[model samples]
Target chain A: MGILEVKDVSKRFGGLKALSDVNLSVEEGTVHAIIGPNGAGKSTLLNCFVGKLIPDTGSVMFEGHSLLGIKPHQINQLGVSRVFQTPEIFSELTVFENVMIACFAKRDGSFRLQPFKTVENETDIVEKAEQMLVDVSMIEKRDMHSASLSRGDKRRLEMAMCLAQDPKLLLLDEPTAGMARADTNNTIELLKDIQKQRGITMAIIEHDMHVVFSLADRITVLAQGTPIVEDVPEKIKGHPKVQEAYLGTAH
Target chain B: MKILGLNEKDSRFLLIVIFLTLATPVLLQPFPEGSGMAQFNAGYPDLMQRFAIFGIFAIGFNILFGLTGYLSFGHAAFLGIGSYAVVWMYKLLDYNVIWGLPLAVVVSGIVALGIGFISLRRSGIYFSILTLAFAQMMFVISYSDLFGRFVGTTITNGETGLQVYGNDPQVLLGATEPSSPHFFGIVMRENFWTPQFGDWQFTFNNGYYFCAVIAILAFYLSLRIFRSPFGLMLRAIKTNQNRLNYTGVHSRPYTLAAFVISGMYAGLAGGLLAAMDPLAGAERMQWTESGTVVLMTILGGAGTLMGPVLGAGFIKYFENIFSKINDNVLHQWFAWMPDGLEDAIVWVLHFFVGKGWHLTLGVLFMLVVIFLPGGLVEGGTRIWRFIRGTDRKEKTADATHQPEHVAYVAEKEEF
Candidate 1:
């Protein structure tokens, strides 16, 4: 059995079927990529994996446990983390503070009411967050407000936040969607370095073919809420359905 | 040499500020006693009391507004419930503040939990409207004749206010006469202080000081919370609720927790107010009173640590000072001008001062909202930035760095 498995998951919004009979399996410690067009239900499927939206049918299993009825925060406790398309760093918080929260969440499960306690006292979590920041090359700007970071730096910080959680599975939804070409390249390199060093499994949603070709060990092409093809990067690059659904527009 | 990786200068500055704040009543005690100074002194303690009480109110409101970005319009009901609970304690078991205060807090907290759990199900404008509706319902119930017209829903004994005589047998300390409940030659006079320096006399009442200490503690607690991991999660929920959920963090429980904590803070403030004055009236729970806390938070800079206190002090000061000024004072100030012009000045002042102080308040609020959306703290920061000449570069850098396009796309993607 794969480390994470989704079997025939389907979701509907009113009359519109957002996802239909989608099936995929991700092995442990592999960089998996989901590439698709705008309305292909990539986000909906990601939402299902994290328990944000329960699928109409089918089951998502992480490790040996079923992820059907678990709450969203409970899912995070089970070692699954997701990064949004827009770098959702707390704009009002300092970079160090932003990562520190993630570290605390990972250590103490959600709903801790230790109001008088200090976050600085958690030496282990602090050390882990500091190490993650260094890995992402964000140590220099750690004191700066998260709002003040460059687009590329924001993505890196978001990645660091996810890393601080020490998750087994990291999900990224269009991690480099609105970044400039240079920033996009920087993010690709950062993700590649992190994957190699940490050996954490990641399932990324991407529109940029270059990022997909460079880092993906395996690729799944989603079109109109269905996984049309799932294969290695070389085979995915030349697949007829993927080309027609996604690459044709690019050409 | 850097402790916890924080700058020494910043740490030192913080230490000094905390020290000064803790020692304010003792350190700032030697100003003079003329009419002007006496007026300032007379206002100081009451202003300080308001600063703490309303500061608590706003801080609680901030948990909902600052963390979750949900504007609650029924927070005053919690405050009212707290005050009423204290009053009931005083009526049933004499003025034993120890019991009254804790009872008030517990009662208010339970009420807040019930209200917050139900209200948090809705989001955005609907949530705000729902809270407003509940507050109005509470106000109506409090004024309804079901509780008797003379007693109202919660009569405050004709506004003579409840008095804690300190002579009841049930009180922890031994019973004493109502007029002089002395312990070691110092009478337990709630409002007794006379600081005379030349022509200026400044008085700081014990009751007011008691309230001040509570307020300071509340402020410090709020500061700690703002720096906590839970606070960060609340802000994350505010910034993007969807993202928090997608990250396997349920937004509901976090938001509900913030709402309840804030409600408890409001309750504490209300209990303190009753402790100082020993009165609980239905009017305190009015929707307008709830709106006032929102005004304080917004006016002071909603998310900043000290902003709400400053906002509360500002509004309370104006309420006291401006309302005291009548047409006579206005006429006296404009007497030197030409008759027609002086009359005109008096007329305009009449429209804003005295009973019309709310008009002045309204205008001030509008100006603050339009010119300084971040409120008084932002205005002060802007002034400081102008003096330092470092604002322009920072603004430009901040503008350039934010991922606006990504935010826009994400917003569109939500549908």
Candidate 2:
């Protein structure tokens, strides 16, 4: 059994079918990339995994438990972390505080009314947060307000926050969607380094062919809300089905 | 060294707050008695006690609204509940204040829990409206004695207000016990000292000291909460509740906890108000009363440690001293000028003092909100930075170290 098992999951919104009978599993320590054309339900599938939306049918099992009928925070406490497309972060707080709150949530679980103990005195959590910032090459900007961070740096800070949680299964939805070439390359290297060091299981949804080929261990290509091909990157590079899905029947 | 588990900076801040609170009677009586400016002196027991009481109220309100960004418009219900609880305690037991104060806190906390659980389901304006609705319902109930009519007995005593009646049972009362509200045998209303120094006279009332001590404790507790991990989570809720939830932090419970804590703070203030004056009015639960604390928190500096206290003192000072300056007092001051010029001065000034005190407060609030979005604390910081001549230097220094993109982003976020 894989760490995350999504079997025969289907969802519909009014008359439109967003996902139909999708089945995928992320192995223990590998980068699983899901690539698809626009309007192919990539984000909808990712949302289903994080408890943001419930599938109309089938089961999403993490380890041995169901991921449905629970809150976003509860799913996170189950060792699953998701990075958003637009980088959802605490903009009013400092970079260090953004990571520290993640660390505190990881340690204290959803809710702990610790009104007396000072945040600076939590040496263990502080050490972990600072180390995460260093790993993301953001330690120098730790004191800077997260709102003032550049878009690329904001993405890095969000990565540091998720990493601070030490999640078992990391979900990335277009991690380099709107980045410059240099920023995208930096993010690719950062992910590669993190995967090599921690062996963290990641499931990335990407449209960038270069990023997918460089980072994905196993690639799943979906067309019209259904998987058209599931194979290694080398095979997916020359697949006729993926070509037809992306370039139309004229190809 | 740390005092009360606080760090050096926090401990120092607490010490300063305590010193200022305790020295209020002496400090407020700046002008000597029989002087022209003596009308502005607010060193009497009544006003000093009010400053401390309202200071505690604002500090607690800040913990919820300032930290979690949950603006509760019905906090006055808890305050009214506290007053009723204390007054009931006095009627049942003796006039000793010790029994009623703790009961007030407990009662208000329970009420807050019920209200917070329901109100926290909504965020932003919806949450505020829910709280306001609950408080309005409570006010109607208290004002018209709805519950009392149901029970066939006077509970809140309706419009006349709740007080210790002459024929009521005082089971804990002794023949020699003090008649009014007291801490054991010590009367809260009695003035312990009135020392005359040169032309100044300072009155140290037992009731004011009692309220001041509790206010100091409340301030210290708030300071600790501000530095705590829970406090960070609360701020995280304010900034981005979505991010907080994704980070595995439950925002609802944190907001609820803050609500209960602030309600308890309001309750304590209410109880103290009753202890000093021995009266509990239904008007204390009015929606306008709730709005006053919101104004205090925002006017002072919402999230800062000392801001609420300063805001409370400022408002209370103006309410008491400024409102006392009637047309006659204005005329007396302007009498030195020529008759026509004096009339002009007093006429213009009349709109800012006495019955028009709220107009002055409204104008000042507008200026603070417009020019200083961070409140009075921001104004103070700006003045301090100007005095030190470091604001311009820091901007230039930052421009050199940061990239142009970063500098642009920083400038955008400055406001």
Candidate 3:
């Protein structure tokens, strides 16, 4: 059984079927890639998993717990972290403050009233945040404002912030989109290092074949709101249905 | 204990507040009593009392507007309500400020809870309009005197206001002598010490000190709120509520808490205003008064620790100094010039000061908003940066960064 199971899920926007009877299973401690062309139901499928949009039918289970009609925060508390397609780091705050808040959330749970406890005095959380920054190689710019950072650096910071929670499952929406070649390679290596060191289960939705082929242990191809194939990355390379999905879109 | 969760930096700020508040009488009365500039001295007990009271009002308003970024246009309702509560306390019980203050706080808190519960359901401009509507409704109720005027029936006594009268039910009073509002027999208007140095005379009254002490407490509490984790959440609400929700935080409760706290502060200031003069007027709760506090917060630099107090003092100082400047004073200053030119200069200046003091304030507000958007505090910081040859710290850096990130992390750590 997979850590995350999407069984017969279907979502519609009025007349259009964004995701129809979709079934996805992300096995624990493995990198699963969900690849699709533009306008495919990849985003819809991911949104359903995260509680942004509720499927009209089907159940999404994380270790046998159903994720339906729950708040986004509750879903997050249930060990799911989503990284947006565009970087959503707090632009107005310093790099250290951004990571520190995440550490507080990790330690304190959903609601807390330790308003009097100084952020500087919380040494353990501070240390953890600093360590996370180091892992992402962002320690040197910890005091700098998060907004001033390059786009690639913002992405890295967002990932580091997510990792700080030590979540069982990580969701990445085009993690390497808009990244320079060097930064993309660095991100790939970082993902590999994290998977090796921490064994985090990641469900990545990507348009970039290079990113998918490089990191994905298992690949799922979707065309016209339906999955055509689910197989290892090497087998996905020559799949005719995948070719039809890509080349068909070209026509 | 730490008194509102003050850190080292906050503690330092509090110390400065305490020092400045205590030194107002001396700091205000700089010139000799008979000198030409003596008229500009703000050392008078009544004016000083106004500084402290309005300082309290602005500080409380700052806690809500500055931190949460919720522009509440109805806060003056709480202040007016507080004044009424105090005045009523004097009429029903005795002329003691102590009895009125706690009741005013409790009543305003309850009122704010009701108002905030409904208003917070909508955010941004809609929320501001809702609050404005509620306050206007309250003003009508108070101004129209909805209750029947039978004995002690009229809730707010209309334009005449609810004042201490000849036959007040002062059951606590043993003395036959007429009493002004007092804190333990120390009369509000009575000056305790008047020291004269050459032609300079300085008067220190019981009321101003009492108000200053309260203002100091208010500043301390504000400092605590600004530093606390609760404050961080409010800042998060200002930045992005969606991010907070995704992070697993229910931000509504935090915003509501800030609203109630600031409302109570307004109530306290209103209560003190009544204690100082033993009268309550419906005009105290008007929308313009609400706008004045907003201007004060923005003028002083809203998000900063010391901005509200500085803004309050700055605005009040201008109101007092400018209003007192008549055409005679203007003419005197320009007498050194040519007769026609002097008359022309005074005529031009007449539109700015004296009876046109508010015009001066309007122009000042415009200039501040245009140039020093961070308010007076930013101006001070900028001047300091210039003198020290240092880089300008950006004002765009906000509280949004802290809580959203925390929530983001919380989502990840939930397992």
TM-score of each: 0.85, 0.95, 0.92
Please give the fraction of native interface contacts (Cα pairs under 8 Å between A and B) kept by each candidate.
0.43, 0.82, 0.38
Candidate 3 has a DockQ of 0.39
Q: Candidate 1 DockQ score?
A: 0.34
Candidate 2 Cα outliers beyond 4 Å, as residue runs: B336-338, B392-415
Tell me the deviation in Å of residue B143 in model 2.
1.0
Worst 10 residues of 1 chain B by lDDT: B403-412
Number of clashing residue pairs in every model?
5, 0, 4
What are the per-residue Cα lDDT tens digits for candidate 1 across A1-251?
A: 77889999999999999999999999899999998999999999888887668999999999988887777678888998888788887775668867877777777776666655556666787898888889888898877777778888988888888888879999888988888999999999988988988899999988789999999999999999999999999998878888799756653
Tell me the deviation in Å of residue B215 in model 2: 0.6
Ranking by lDDT: 2, 3, 1
- Candidate number with greatest TM-score: 2
Per-residue lDDT of A206 in model 1 = 86
Q: Which of 1 and 3 is ahead in TM-score?
A: 3
What is the full ranking by DockQ, best candidate first?
2, 3, 1
Residue-wise C-alpha lDDT for candidate 1, range B130-152, written one tens digit per residue: 88888777766665523445554
Between candidates 1 and 2, the one scoring higher on lDDT is 2
